[model samples]
Target: MSARSNRQIVLKSRPLGIPRAEHFEIRAAPVPALQPGQFLVQNLFLSVDPAMRGWVNAAANYSEPVGLGEVMRAFAAGRVIASRHPEYPEGALVMGMLGWQEYAVSDGQAIRRRVTETDLPLSLSLGVLGLNGVTAYFALQELGEPRPGETVAVSTAAGAVGSIAGQLARLRGCRTVGIAGGADKCALCLSEFGYDAAIDYRQPDLPDALRQSCPDGIDVYFDNTAGLISDAVLPQINRHARIIVCGTASVASWDPWPQGPRVERHLLNKAARMAGFLIWDYEHRYEEAIAHLAPLVRSGELRFREEILDGLEAAPGSIADLYEGTNLGKRLIRLADR
Candidate 1:
């Protein structure tokens, strides 16, 4: 293969809230030569996630903010086209922080894992077989500890992680209720993802809808949106209910820390437990989760969705679109074919 220039979407300016296309700029640069123990990756699929909102914000998140003029930080799946590294040899597929560029040079430190499931689409490594899937697996099982016949309520139930989490809960014999933005997504939650009940949070009577769906009260709540959705769910927790804090997609900024109904009293009354979940915390157990989820995906026992946008041009505004719920499923920008 011949060498070529790399195209990257770099952060042009920091945004106060949701980042738009104007905040980024596309630039061409010569692909860096591989150094000792380094490899060159031709990224095929770039991920667009809600967590990206925090990555571009001025506020410090779990990881450092993407610096100005740098390629936008993201998880991508790709093939190693050139290599000096023995482990990540040429032709090996990899997934990790490869950013929003067509080509990435890595020393393997930022590479999360090798794409071992060759039978699955390489794109799945960026979604269900990657961080999102592992996150849903660990957070729900370890933190929520849901029991059979219990009621499991999931916010953003039509999204990447929530959809998987809801399905996992259902497979465990728990009754699953999904909370989504629109009626279409709510319907998807029921028909596609197998949620027993679906609630449109955009409706005026969210609390009423939640109450009706979770008649026995919520035994476990997988919270992806932490604003109004959580407000309605918290008050309905059953005795010893478990709450998993996954993502804060609804709230754009946490600068002043958006205020809402206090949850101390609710937890005290119900003897409930709420814990935050970050996928990085469970990095060591990623393969374990993948081992369990892969077979289910292959057998069609587990279902997943993907919305692909062609070319790097889609990279700039994709994150904003994610927050607006424009995509039906896990969103990815296709830069090349695997």
Candidate 2:
């Protein structure tokens, strides 16, 4: 085997609400010999996204369920160790849905980005420069439509998507407020990401704190948490405000749906518009977004943090950890020996 073989994290069962270790199985597998039109990729980075929780359950929203006994699905970046296809040569790096494994055989159909000029980091393809970044960028431009001098707020403020969203809003000259779970994340939001203000959702009263943070009413609410944390801010929206419904982190447990404040009166009072977005729906403009974001990242205006586990055997539990807010920014697993 070109890379470490005999390793995988398989789905033991579909999760109920918060996932447990019993939902996953780590196993050994022999690396099959490569043949014509086939390519063997040595996994380098595996992503653990919160969306994986919904994917592990019954089909809801937009994404499909993760079939039983399948290698837990994920986006990953890796190097080609053995290739039999004309275009996919050995030693080339590619990014795709490589699943939770140290090694995988592909027909080259899943290959997304063929690592060429970009020498940033292979792990980034699974995190900031990849799906998370695109999702954040799209939700802001399409849903929030932030304007200069406006006040913008984001939930999940220190997370992968939220971090980028705050920076983008700030870049547009918006007064940005971030709502994260803890003081540490709130500090990171304000100090590291330069958000104008940040509120710890763990506080006793979220709405009161949000009121103090945004004294001038929220102009654009980039919501990542859709329960009480979101409801707390709804009553304070500005007239003609835009509410970008990015993700509902509070409902990540996949359990009995959470109960939040009824905000119909607040919407009537503010006349705000709330819109939900799906990342894949913006695929046609993906490159356009990267074109806009890449230079900003290169110019040091944007930063990314990743909490990476060392092997594929940790993929399943790492995914469960994501929903618990254990990951600082982007959660990833490194399959290659670094």
Candidate 3:
């Protein structure tokens, strides 16, 4: 086999709000040959996400910052090229924190066992079948706990996690309201994702729009865009409401973290509970999520949407689109050339 080659994107700068190409550098890398229990992988699909921004910052968070000159961090699907370990064969496909690259090196432990079926499409493994899928599942089920006849609202309802949350909320017999940016996204939430109503926040009087869409009172808010949108739902919260803080898309812009709407009063008045979760906290239950979600997905009772870009070079821009809410669903980059 020819020696491994890589095209890796490294972080050039800490972004202000929206990331630009200047913030990244695409570099050609020579992969080291395999050693005992170590292997080389040709990446097939790259996962781009909003959380990547936080991963780059030196400030405090759940995970350490991606070093300034390192390959920008990411989760990806790749196929093994050369494996010295008996456990990892020469051609197995897998998923891990492989970053934005055409190739990755792994000791079988760094990356784990992979499923080889291409029938499901290798790309889906990085999204609906990967961390994104698990995040949506755990956050919704563990945090939201929707009750029958209650109202469940979600921001970014057309995106990866938000879309799934909406469907699960519906399964619980709740009135689902989706808050998305444009009218098109709003329409997709209702028509494609089965949301009962979609409020286009781009319209003036967004709080009023939310009110009209969720007239029954908000019982559970699966908040993906927590800022003003979360504020809008607070007053409408029923007695003993629940808020699952998933993402803060509304303040995705960089610089100083934007001030959020004052919600203490509402929290006090309603006795509602708001909880933020780190999806990895439930990593132990990842297989459980896949076992359950895969059936729903394959059966068509669930919908999967991916905004796939053409190549690794497009990875940084794809993540920028996620924070801007420009992409329709899960924003991802295809690492394979096919």
Candidate 4:
């Protein structure tokens, strides 16, 4: 790759299940000239999320799939190196759908927001202060509606969004229970994220464990995994419980729509409310969530974790690793210094 050329990871093919490195290709292409109302960004950090799996799958999802031979769509944080737009002036810091590339040209619509929290690390715009944190905030607070003295259970409790949701429930005076894949993650939920109880879903007697952990019955269930883990949780919901369906990490393929135990009976019997949460629906309130979380982050009241790979070459396999539970927190790839 030449010094002036932009390096990118483009989609090579669609995947049958979890995306692997084989589905992507790295290529060097000349940087394009900025057009009117456009800005060029030199990306510093690229996010690796489970949602990327849906983005590349051939199945229909909330968003269209990334076309073959196109730059892998991704959230990236960077500083504007050149611009023909007034709002995105040169040297301004920003983050959004910048794709898996070292440099990106945007017309500002693809820009989610400008990075204004100068006191914090710019990389945070893609994690805690970005979509992950915001999603946790709205999904738990708005949809889950946790109350003091309630029992709130979170699946993938040691994960990026789940960890924050657990902490928020704890702060609200609710008893938080975390369900994770292994012993170490269960330990992480208890020790770091402040969960009252932690259950390892890998255990054969998962339903029994959930019963023991949430003895009072869960009043708010922040579900990230929607297969067996959900089957265990639905049976433990109390009357008027609020269940937030945030992510479907347990189910690899939605093309055939994996079958599971019926949940309508549980919801009807318990008189519980179940709703799906999409972060994009709450875009207008993004600043409200950031304003609320940033102070807590700086004051050490709110906590988070991140696992970062050193370069763009790591992007191809990062999503697969994320689904395999290799990442302890929000996963990101560093392309350059912020």
Candidate 5:
């Protein structure tokens, strides 16, 4: 109804570095009446991702940037409270690009899937059971192709994608090494994420630490943070290695791309392959990933953590928290309880 207010966080301007709360405006608008083919979702959990930085940037990225004055783009899990559409009936749980709002209206175009598995927590739809997990599933298994007894290294190893990638590599019989930000995260990588070794990138002797942990040279490098971390991994790559370029968390901008040490020589000498992966490309196979991952997650073989903020108001600060390494795992905002 027009009388009902929908709280939203709008992108006021494109951010240069890590986005600040000031770059976004929190406001309330009257919830619009639904038209034919439309359904209204009362978003319960909103995902806060590191990829949001690129989403809000003015420069070219994987997708179009969230335009100024628009609701900041995000993934969310919610229940349909009202619907003019027959397929998406009221009380149906769905996951989609619901944006940073208390509610979202959809025609089912952007809906990723219906949240069918209820045994696990619904928030997992945005984490290990969602995009983050799917990214790890296909990227490591398909792109990385990590062979048994090989060394697999992941950057941002305690973060969502990296953590799962490390665990998946371990399951495949690879020697998994996690490169994270600090001692606490490194400890988590070793204990919780099933990594054989952990390297803290913040340590002054990172190169030495990496060499010690991965003495045989990395067979698969699941690169999430591509700046300094990738710089370190490049020289340690073994022959016929695979590098999965999933994210660039360490460096914010890519338009006037900052120069780094050349990788030509390394690839030539090692006969390694490096490629970028976008999950959207594998949208057709999400069910396969979910089927494979849901069991592992439910079985407790794959460990995950959710750093949930209390309300929709916490949305703006969540991105800053992600970039600053304040969150231990998948960062999400609890808008309402299903």
Candidate 6:
């Protein structure tokens, strides 16, 4: 019989700034025959994340950059089609760092967990029930510590993590305000995501908008884009506010760093605390988060949106699109039928 083929996308070079499609090389190679203790996963969905930019950059980050000539790193959900390992049998659905490929060989190290919630779409394993939801769950509950009637302001409020975080804050009795790029996304934040008010950040005067929307000042600022959005929000923080730094999407580059307003005076005046959060730090509590979030998701209390592309080839450009504010929600690439 002819050998089975694998379609893969590997990093051709490290991106100088935001990664572009030219930095990746798509190739088809013979799928390896699994050895003992190994399994083969036919990836069904590949997650494209904003964090991927940092993953490909040479600069120091929480995780090492994807090496040249290696498969582009990604989170994915797939089913085992061939298995020589007992723990992962054929047809078992799993989620892990499956990279940008139609198939992946696993010795089981990168697997985060096997998918157990069967009621929802499998693609959701990469969204609300996955890292995005987990990030929102812990980052807010642990760091934000929102109180009843407190004001929680979230940047990128129409995106995956921000949308979920805003909803979660609402459930906790905080008045939620969302800051998104356009009027449409702002409407979604109010109508769909349950924000008390939504601010369109594309406006010329962001500081004035923030002041009008958050008249009492922000009690918890969930900062996803830490450039100008943060610059405006910082000045409106209430006394003893908690600022959760989740992402830096607004800035084009972070190498030499972009110059902006200094925050020392604002933080000092408000007695506010600003801290960075990474989901991996709470890895041990994955199931704990799932337990709380899965129910909310199932009951329709926690809502999410996804923007899916057609194939593996669409993966590279999707990353660029995400940074460009073109993606509507959690961006993903569908590789096969679930």
Each candidate's TM vs. the true structure? 0.98, 0.93, 0.94, 0.98, 0.98, 0.97
Model 6 C-alpha lDDT per residue in residues 29-117, reported as the tens digit of each score: 88888899999999999999999999999885899889998889999999999899999999999999999998899999989989999
Residue lDDT tens for model 2, 1-338: 54345588887887777556789898887888777899998888888887777778864657677788888878888888888888989889888888888788999777667755355777777766788988989899988999999999999989999999999999999999999987788888977888999998888988899889999989999888798888788888999899988887788564466666787777777787988888879866767777787788778899878887886567667766766766687888887752
Question: What lDDT score is found at residue 335 in candidate 1?
Answer: 92
* TM-score of predicted structure 4: 0.98
Model 6 misplacement above 4 A: none
For model 4, residues 24-72, the per-residue Cα lDDT tens digits are 9999999877788988999999999889999999986899999999999
Error of 6 at 59 (Å): 1.3
User: Residue 169 of candidate 1: its Cα lDDT?
Assistant: 99
Please write out the lDDT profile of model 3 over residues 143-260, one tens digit for every residue.
8888889899988888888888889888878889998889889889988999999998778898888778878789999888777777778889888988999887777554575786
Candidate 3 global CA lDDT score? 0.80
What is the Cα-based lDDT of residue 29 in candidate 5? 88
Tens digits of per-residue lDDT for model 1, 1-338: 23579999999999999999999999999886678999999999999999898999999889899999999999999999899999999999999999999999999998999999998899999889988999999999999998999999999999999999999999999999999999899999999999999999999999999999998999999999999999999989999999999999889888888999999999999999999999988999999999999999999988999999999998898888988888999999999877
Scored by CA lDDT, what does every candidate get?
Answer: 0.94, 0.82, 0.80, 0.92, 0.91, 0.92
- For the record, the alpha-carbon RMSD of candidate 5 to the native fold, in angstroms, is 1.0
Residues 158-276 of candidate 5 have per-residue lDDT tens digits of 99999999999999999999999888999999889989999989988788888999989999999998888899889999999999999988887776777899999999998999999
Winner on TM-score between 1 and 2 is 1
Query: What lDDT is obtained when candidate 2 is compared to the true structure?
Result: 0.82
What does the lDDT come to for candidate 5?
0.91
lDDT of 6: 0.92
Would you give me the overall lDDT of model 1? Answer: 0.94
Better of 2 and 5 by lDDT: 5
